[model samples]
Target: MSHLSRTLPIKRAAHVYLVHEGQLLLVEERMDDGSIFYGLPGGKANAGETLGDAAVRQVLVETGLRVTDLMFVSLIEGELLTGTRNECYANFGRFTASFSGDLAPTDPEVVGVKWVPFEQVEGLVRYGPPPEVEERNPLIWVPTRDFVRGQPRAYYPI
Candidate 1:
């Protein structure tokens, strides 16, 4: 078999939008330069698992929170090359839900959790580490922020 055939493909993932008050819940990704970037709390599905269930499980794993009233939202998906490995990330039925419990990072990669102001998305996307990464992933915070602020445009690829 060719090397490409031997390589693995990341087929699916589920991320959640957890909002409370005027802020959105996010997990920290500390870059090599010590700058903090944020992403939603969720991950890929295991074999024979459902997306919503995976969302619930991943949220609990990453943030130690329980989510309820899962409502489907926009889907952001495409294929990309990550360090010479071609992977397709298809996130179907992205969800928003109400969460409760004290936040904690059970995953080592998640060093911290915070409720970022909805407005921070603009700056994070505009001035984040390399515009290239931002372009690859759209301004995801927009939809969640709008939804939180009750200004409409909740589900989005913006």
Candidate 2:
């Protein structure tokens, strides 16, 4: 396999959007450079882990919240461009789940956590959708907004 294709599965991750009263549970991820971006609480899944388990673990670890009553909402897949050049990192299999728990920041991975009103996510998106993404990039919002709207399809490269 080519170098690009060989690294296609490097960054597989999952996210859970715990919505209650039109608010989304989001995490302020801290970049190595001290910048931040807001996004649903989640992280990488362990080997052979189920999507649901990954969702719950990520949410609890990042936000100090236990996700119960969770349900599969959507499936998202797309390319993730890290700081690495021409790497073509694949951050596919983004999924959203519903759940409930007291909101708090539980993991050091996140700089901060907040429950953003659904209407406000757009503003956050404009400011840099998620710290996992390259700041000031428009592609970050493409998958997030689609997930929020119950449409998880990513625009596959043509």
Candidate 3:
């Protein structure tokens, strides 16, 4: 029997951070009941697709942007309670990418897309939580900030 059968269902997700002039591209999505949330532009990788390709495709689909210059940033393993799949554990690849295109929302996953100055994201995130709330909340992040300040990228489980 395959060892996959004995392990908890594992889901792969990519998060693309589109940075330009110290700002980051973001998606604002609405739930069926009209609640709103914020998130980076990315999604699941298709079968046999590289994480880089998945990030590029997801950015274009979710935010109507063509992404290039992708770089791997961090690998995160955590517990996420996404509504569609409440897996207790998930592994995620976070990437930094450069993109160019008219700002628009193309995929149904996003209701709005925009660029926000990085420094101001904390305030915005405080009010507009990410879609995968338990997974992508800024409150749980420390890697990028720490890395910039020459600190280690060690993440403590919350």
Q: Pick the candidate with the highest lDDT.
A: 1
RMSD of each predicted structure: 5.3, 4.0, 4.7
lDDT (Cα, tens digit) per residue for candidate 1, span 1-158: 12344435656668887877667787877655677767778877888888899999999989999999898776654443344334444444468898888887788778898887777745554244443343224544555445556664534432
The Cα local distance difference test for each model comes to 0.67, 0.65, 0.66
Per-candidate TM equals 0.72, 0.72, 0.75
lDDT of 3 at 34: 70
Per-residue lDDT of 55-94 in model 2, one digit per residue for the tens?
7888888988877756655454445555445334544344
Q: In angstroms, give how far residue 123 of model 1 lies from its true place.
A: 1.8
**Candidate 1 Cα lDDT to native:** 0.67
Regions more than 4 Å wrong, model 3: 1-6, 82-85, 126-133, 136-158
Between candidates 1 and 2, the TM-score winner: 2
Q: TM-score order of candidates, best first? A: 3, 2, 1
Ranked by lDDT, top first:
1, 3, 2
Poorest 10 consecutive residues by lDDT, candidate 1: 127-136
